[model samples]
Target: MNPRILLWLAVGLVVWAVIPFVVPRYIADLLVFTGIYTVAGLGIGLLLGHCGIVNLAQATFYGLGAYASAYCTVMMGLPSVVGFLVGAVISMALAYVIGRPILRLTGYFLALGTLALSAIASALFFEWDWLTGGTLGIGGIPKLDLFGFLLDRPSRYYFFVWIVAFACMAVARNLVDSRTGLMLRAMRDSSTAAAALSIDLQALRTKVFVVCALFGSLAGSLFAHHASFVSTQSFTVDRSISFLLIPVIGGATSIPGIVVGALFVTFLPELLSKLGDIHQILFGLALVAVVVLMPEGLVGAFGKLRARLAKRGGGNG
Candidate 1:
């Protein structure tokens, strides 16, 4: 929509395309991590942006995918490709079943229920010794092989991640322009009015919930394969908080906002961690300041600033 922003995105893609080729493997990894976080955040955008659902159990879907892949590949001896798809399907079915009842609630009640689900999922990951290896997590996840070709190198894996990230963004953009996306947006804006007009509120919310779960699962599958390990710490309540934090910080209404928010939240912290305790304190303070100053979000603030400058210029003319 904004030509300037489109130009910026095109430039960014160009940078991303060149970085792995030029940068060291370890540094390239941080960018990969950012991409992974953005992919997961886009799923949160689908629910929070389009569907207007604050799903507190998002990390459960993520953990489910990681563990599912671990179980299928490491335990069941399945191929990596099969294991990945299986992970997503398992998360989808699980979310669909749970969302049936859970989707009926609204506001605080739905939040509370999803929060409870997050706790349950974490507990299972820790307690299910036989199935999940309990608190120890899973390691030595086999590197993916496409026929005779083995994708064991970091450079090769980078392509896998980038391609998926682009695909996820494309899918979200497409869905937002479709009939289902329109229905989700309408229901999100007002269930009461939607119900008045005969929208099946419960069914619609349930489907969106499944969509969130499926995307989260997709991110999780990539994560497990890339890291070659799965752990409860990697997909827990705090992790879910970070996932929610991104779209809110970026302005949930726009895809670019979520992507930017995810990148900032992911790498900026690690960069600050190197600067000592004062930096950590400043980071927290900065977060609070941003929330208070830009409650409508970063993109919203920028839009307002642009409008104000335009108005001032017109008056001077």
Candidate 2:
């Protein structure tokens, strides 16, 4: 690795260690959400960036994980890890079963199919109030105990959440650098060419879709523990859109871009809210600007700017 990269990473680690202590409690709380969103958005990033798939059903898996955690830990009195595992298994199974047929659709049709799945899941979350608690939500979810150390506060929870996010990021990086990633990209660029090359597009896509579901589920489980509540509103279409935006606004093809996008989604809205009632309007316009002006996202645009500056400096020298 480059020495400069190592130096920057060390600096980032120092900053990460200090942030929870120096920042306001609410800010620390938002950072926790950012980590959770990073986990959720990573799957979308993988599908969108590598497989050229637009998945809007992430919230469905997210909700599955949240509700599973809520029901297991609160209602069934099971361990938190069991809740996480159950949610992941259910989400992955659903994705595999649903993806087989849905993966057959191409372009906008596939996008719409995923959107419909999100909508249906949201409805089920509402109608199945006995399990989900509907508008009332499930609460009193206990804090995690890691070797008798209670993660009862935002500062403590922040470390756990981000650790999971980093782990997920590592897994994503591995996938992206693997041979399957090449096939995914090939299929994305030209399904016909990939097919001619003997690639199993359907199975490959379904695998990625299942992986996406697992990420979403893990994120939801994390959210449940952090928030101590789970509700239908949190798993709605709007939330799904927010997850999609993380990759879109952060540069889908970049692993670190997922963190950038999560920060944008989590922090920008909070920062804008200080402006009062017009904050939503401002945020909308800001998103529009990002889409219009920086089509490749913040990370991509920054990379281009850095490259340009380097070229200019070299020319001057």
User: Each candidate's lDDT (Cα)?
Assistant: 0.82, 0.96
Top candidate on lDDT is 2
Q: In model 2, what is the error at residue 102, expressed in angstroms?
A: 0.8
Give the Cα-based TM-score of candidate 1 against the true structure.
0.91
Point out the worst 10-residue segment of candidate 2 by lDDT: 288-297
Error of 1 at 157 (Å): 2.4
lDDT per residue, candidate 1, 1-317, as tens digits? Answer: 89999999899889877878898887677767767777788888888888777878878888888888888899888887777788789989999999998877888898788888888888888888787787788898987776776767777777777788888889889989998888888888887888898889888888778888888888888888878888788878888878888888888878878777877787778778888877768767767877899986788788899999999999999
lDDT of 1 at 253: 78
What TM-score fits each model?
A: 0.91, 0.99
User: Residue-wise lDDT of candidate 2 within 266-296, one digit each (tens)?
Assistant: 9999999999999999989989988888888
User: Model 2 segments beyond 4 Å from truth?
Assistant: none
| C-alpha RMSD (angstroms) for model 1 | 2.4
Task: Compute the lDDT for candidate 1.
Answer: 0.82
